[model samples]
Target: MKVENLYSKSEENPMKALVFDKSGIENLKLKEIENPTLGPHDVLIRVEKSGVNPIDYFVVNYIPVKPMPHIPGAEIAGTVEKVGDHVKGINKGDKVIVYNRIFDGSCDLCLSGREMLCRNGGIMSVITNGGWSEYFAIPDKNVFKIPENMDWDLAASLPVAALTSYHAIKELEVSPNDIVVIFGASGNTGMFAVQLAKKFGAIVIAVSKKNWLKEFGADYVVGYNEVVEKVKEITEGKMANVVINSLGSSVWDKSLEVLGYNGKLALFGTLTGADVKINLSSIYSKHAKIIGTTGGSRRDLIELINLCRDCRVKVWKTYKLEEGAEALRQIMSENRDGRVMLQL
Candidate 1:
C-alpha cells in the first residue's frame, strides 16, 4: 500500500473536519479547513481511524466555548506523513497511535515521568483541535508506533479508553486473588477496565444494568434494583478488593459500599453526571481509598500497544471515518458493546 503524505502542504491545501459551532448543541457540520501547520517537534499524521469517546460529546455540548467551531475527538490511529525538524526515532509512513496529552518535558511532572499529570498538560480535542479530521499534527513524543499488522481501528481505540484503563488498573495494584468490581462494565472504557483488571489476575465482578452484564463477562451482574445487596451477596458479605468506577456518580455510592476494608476505588470518568453524595463514614470506616485518574503516559501507551500487538488484548470493532458521528451516537446511547473506531 502506498501511504499518502497529506500533511505535505503546498501553497493551497484544505482538510475536511467535523466541527461544532457552539456548546449545548449536537450538530457537527463537516467543513473544509486549512491544514494545520506543523511545529519543529511535531509529526503530521494522515488519520486512518479516529476513536469516538463520550468526552467528545460532553465537551461539545457542555464545555464553555474556547473558540468558535471546535473539532472534538481524541483517540486516533494513522500513518505519520511528515516529521518536523527536531523529531527523531519516528519516520514518515510509520503506523502510530496519537496520545492526546501534550506536555513540556521540562515540567516537574514530566520530568518525574508523569506527563499525563503535568500542570501544563493539554488534551487533544479539548484544549485544541483533535483527530476528527483527515489530518492532524501533534508532538512527535505523543505518537506511539503501532505495529504494522495491528488493525487501524483497534489502534485508534487505544489512546484514551484503553490508556485510562491501564492507568487505573496500575493504580489499583491488582493481584491474582483480588476481587475487582467494574462499574458500567459494558461501556468502552469500562469494558477495557474489566478486561485489564482480569488480565492483572483479579477476579472480575462486572456491574452494569441487568441486560448488559452477560456481555461484559461479569461473574456477578446486577441491575439498579438491590445493586448493593447483590454485590454483597456475590462477595459473600466481603465485597471487592478493588472497585473501578468509570460511570462516576451513578455508581459512586454502590462502588464505595461494595469495597472490602482497605480496598481501592479508582474513579476514571463521569459518564453518568458528576455530582453525587457520599457518606464519609463508609470511606473512613473501611479505610477505602478513592483515587482519581485521568490519562496515561507515553510509556503506558507503549506498553498497551505492545500488549495488543502480542494478542494479549483485542479490540471490539472498527468503523470508517465517514461513520464517525454514528459511532459516537451508538457509544453515547449505550448501544455499542465495545470500542467503536472511525477508519480513514
Candidate 2:
C-alpha cells in the first residue's frame, strides 16, 4: 500500500515529529511526514503515545546520523494495523509496546540470553527510525502486546526507563534488608529504579536534589554535594549493599564511597560525562563489584509489563503526540516533575 494511503491526509495527517537534520536542535521541527512501510517481519502501528528519553536529545545533537534527516524517539505504544507474513503470537488491532533493541538473534550474546548486548544489535531510534511520528513500523520481535485496558501513555513510558531499572535491580538480586542507594533518583530511570528496588524488598536510600526527595521515595535524600556524608550518616558508617548510579561521573566517586564491603554498584547511564576517575584501592580492598546494564531482554520486558498491569508501579504523566518535541525539551530542561509521554 502507498504511504499516503495508510494515513488520512485530509484529516490532519501531520505526524508531529522532532526532526534532527544537519543543523542541530535549531533544526528540530514538529511536522507531518509520510507513513512508514512495513517489512516482512514487521508490524505497522498507529502510535497512540511515545516516550521522550535523555538519549533522544543526545542522539539529535551529539551523535552523528548517517544522513541529514532523522526522527528521534525510542519508546512507543500503539495498535497493530498490519502484520508481516512471518509475524506470530500477535495480530492486527492488538495494543503493544515497542522495544528499541533490534538484534540478529544469532550472536553470542543472544545465544547467552543477553540480546541487549549483541555486538551487532541495532537500536531503533539510534540506528533506525523510531516512535516520534503518529505511525511507524517495527519488527515483530520488537513489539510486546499490552493489555487492552492499559493506558497508551503508560505503555509508551514503561519500555525504556522502566526496563533499564528492571535489568539493573534484577541483576543485583536485591533482597529484603539490603541497603540500596539510588543516585539521580528523580530522573525517569532513577524513579523506576527506586520503586523497583523497594518492590524487591530492599531498603532504598535515594540521593537526589533536595527538591526531588519527596517524590523519589528515599529513606534519606540529600543534595548532590552532600551525598557521601548524608549516605554515610544514614547507613551509620555501614554503607549501602547496592548503589545504582545513573549520574555517572558526577556521582561516581560518591556512589563508590557509600557502598558497604562487597557492595555492588550497577552503572546504567552516563547522564554526566563519560570520563571518570576511580580509586582502585576502594574497589580492591572492599572487594566490591561494578556492573553495567542497558536495555532489557525480552523476558525482562514481560516481567515489567506484569508489574505495571498489577498496579505495583505507575507511570507519572502523559502528553499528546503533537507535543513530542515539547516533551523532549522538558526532559532536557530537567524542570519536569514526572515522566513525559507523547500520546497519539
Candidate 3:
C-alpha cells in the first residue's frame, strides 16, 4: 500500500491521553489532551487497546526528536472514529490495527518493499503523540481492519511483538527440516519466533527455561547455560542451520558455537548489550552469514492477524489500559510468559 499524504488537523475537543511532559517514567501523566483532527488522507481512531514494550521505556527517556507532552505506545488497536475524505477501504466504526511504522512510500527502500529500512520512516508514539490517548490520527494506509470478532487487546499486542518476530524469522528464511535454535525464546518476540519457525517447518530448539516454553511450538527447550551443549546433542554433532539471537551480546559467542556449515545467524535485538567482538576465523571457518533485522512491514501485520485468528499466535494474559505501566513491567518480569496485553 502507498502512503499518499499524512497531515493532522487540530480538533476543538480534548480527549484523555497519557503524557510525559518531561523525561522519566514517573513523569508519565494521564490527562485531557487535544484530539487530532482527521486529514483527508488520514483516519482518526478512537483507541480501544494498546500494548507496552521495553522500547517504550527507552523512548520515554531517549529519542530527543519527540517533543515534551508526547504520548508513548507502539502497539495500538482501535475503531475508526472517522475516515478522511480521501480515504478508501476504511470506514468509520471499523475495528483496526495501526501500522505503527510511518514511512514515505516514494522512498527507494519503501518502494522496494523494504519499508522497515526506509530512512524516512518514524515510529508512531515516538515521533508524535500516539495511542495512549482515546483519539489518534494516522495515514489511512497505516490503519488495518482486524476481524470484527477479534479481541482488541490481542490485536494490540500483535503490531510490535508479532511483527518484529515475523520479520526476523523471515529474514533468516528458516526452512522446513532446518535445525533452528532460538535464543530468548520466552520473551514476547522470542515466543513468536519459536512459533513462526515451527510454522515454517523448522526443527526449533528454544533457549529458555525448559518448562516456560514447552506449551509453545518449541521442539525442545533448554536453559541458557546448557544451550550450546544441548543443541549439539540434539543435532548429533551437526549443530543448527540457523541461530536467532535476540538477546544480543550475552549469547553471541554461544550462538556462533552451535552453528553448522553455511549457518545463518539472525540478530534482531540488543537486550543484553549492543557491542560484541566478532570471531572472523569462526565465521569464515563455518562459512556462516550474519543478518540483522528489525520491525516488519504492514503486510506482515495483516498476516499476523490471520495467524492469530487461526490460533497460531498465543495470548497468555491481559491487563486493562489503566494498568499499561504494569503491563510493560510484566513483559520484563520472569513470570510473564507469552504475550501480555492491555484492554482499553
Superior candidate under lDDT, 1 versus 2 = 2
TM-score of 1: 0.88
Count of steric clashes across candidates, in order: 2, 4, 0
Best by TM-score: 3
Candidate 3 segments whose C-alpha is farther than 4 A from its true place? 1-13, 210-212, 312-317
> What residue runs in model 1 are displaced by over 4 Å at the alpha carbon?
1-11, 24-27, 65-67, 209-220, 224-226, 310-326
- Mind sharing the TM-score for model 2? 0.88
Better of 2 and 3 by TM-score: 3
Kindly list the per-residue Cα lDDT of model 3 for residues 289-320, writing each as its tens digit: 99998888977877877876743445567776
**CA lDDT, candidate 2, residue 328:** 61
lDDT of 1 by residue, 1-344 (tens): 00111244553778888877876435776777778777777888888877777877677777753445687777888899998889989999999888888677788999988888878756777767677888888877788898889876567778987889988898778899798888877776776777677667777877766454444445666665576787688778998899888887877878887899999999988877799987899999999898998888888888888765532223456655555566666667545555666666
lDDT by residue for model 2 (46-121), tens: 8877777888777777876533477778888889888988889889999999877878889899988888888887
List the global CA lDDT of all models.
0.76, 0.77, 0.79
TM-score (all chains, Cα) for each model: 0.88, 0.88, 0.92
Best-first order by TM-score: 3, 2, 1
